[model samples]
Target: MARMPSAERRRQLTEAAIRAMTRDGVPRTTTRSIAAEAGVSLSVFHYCFDSKQELLESVMTTITEHYVAVVRDAIRPRATVRETIRAGLQAYWDHVAAHPGEHMLTYELTQYALRQPGFGHLARRQYELYAEIYEALIEQLAAGMELDPSVKVPVLARYLAAMTDGLTLNFLVAGDAGAAADILDVIADHVADLFRADT
Candidate 1:
């Protein structure tokens, strides 16, 4: 048994749980450990998150929300689609580079979701949303150019996304942020080329 915690305290605990998850990973981030790390009682942890899965879901939502908000905020009304996408990519690169542990945790969740159909649905939903955003960026970037009807817009989006994800994976493994930038520049050039291609 533990003392009741304030709402602010609960928020703090949740944030601490996120930090712990980032640092220790999914298997290691138990409620007791989080409570201890947060300087709160076990009851506080229970009161805030019904279960470890709930806590992880909240953490995932929080991270994704932050990523989406940052990209949205960086959007400029006068900027062209490529410019907006460049800004978004830079933001994502920076965010991922800064939070490798959290990213590894995300990958772990994705792997776990592979075995759980319901969770896989959640993953697919998120994937669709992200894909749609990137597809819109691609469409806007190539607004004046005609594309090969055979090359679906969704396929382009997936390719662009794969390029970014590949760079991210390289950075994660090699720990080279500069290499990630160079890779993005290369990807951007390729995207431009695609946009310039004749129908």
Candidate 2:
């Protein structure tokens, strides 16, 4: 019989895996490296995840869920919609500044997903998750919006999410998060105006 993992052990392993993959990208991320990074043996990796594919999938899912939750929690419902949006975007900036390479794993995953059908599903799931966050923010702030009825809220949300992701990526590439931060407020304000015009 296999020994069950304690909660702490499980979390430590998962987090170690996250750090390793994020830092080294998927091609270089091996079970052995992950095990060493986590201060465990190959057997421990096998016990926690059935295969490398399974572990990769779980790591991506974990990263996606954690980032999504951070975006969701960026705003308080009680705050003004504009404030909520700013808070959320700011949280993202902070996250990126702290974990630059981490998102590179996501970018790499995005590229992989774009080509492979299996990973493509993960990419689609991530887009939908982002759209969901955007929708929530718009729905909270946008009432009687004036854009084309068919695409109004969703369109706004898509643009905002897309722009936010783009800016994050650009900052990472340029190594100038401060430069990006300077423009974020203006962009958010513009987004607010774009959607709130009809409200």
Q: Which candidate achieves the best TM-score against the true structure?
A: 2
Clashes of each: 0, 0
Runs in model 2 lying further than 4 Å from the true structure: 1-11, 77-79, 115-118, 137-151, 194-199
Best by lDDT: 2
Q: Tens-digit lDDT track for model 2 on 1-199? A: 2455655555666678889878877777788888899888788777777755566566666676666667667765434455656777887777877777777777887776677656667777767867887788667555544444556777778888788889888887888867887778877677655543443
Q: What CA RMSD would candidate 2 show?
A: 4.0
Q: What is the lDDT of candidate 1?
A: 0.68
Instruction: Report clash pairs, candidate 2.
Output: none
Q: What would the C-alpha RMSD of candidate 1 be, to one decimal place? A: 4.8
Instruction: Give the whole-model CA lDDT for all candidates, comma-separated.
Output: 0.68, 0.71
Each model's Cα RMSD:
4.8, 4.0
lDDT of 2: 0.71
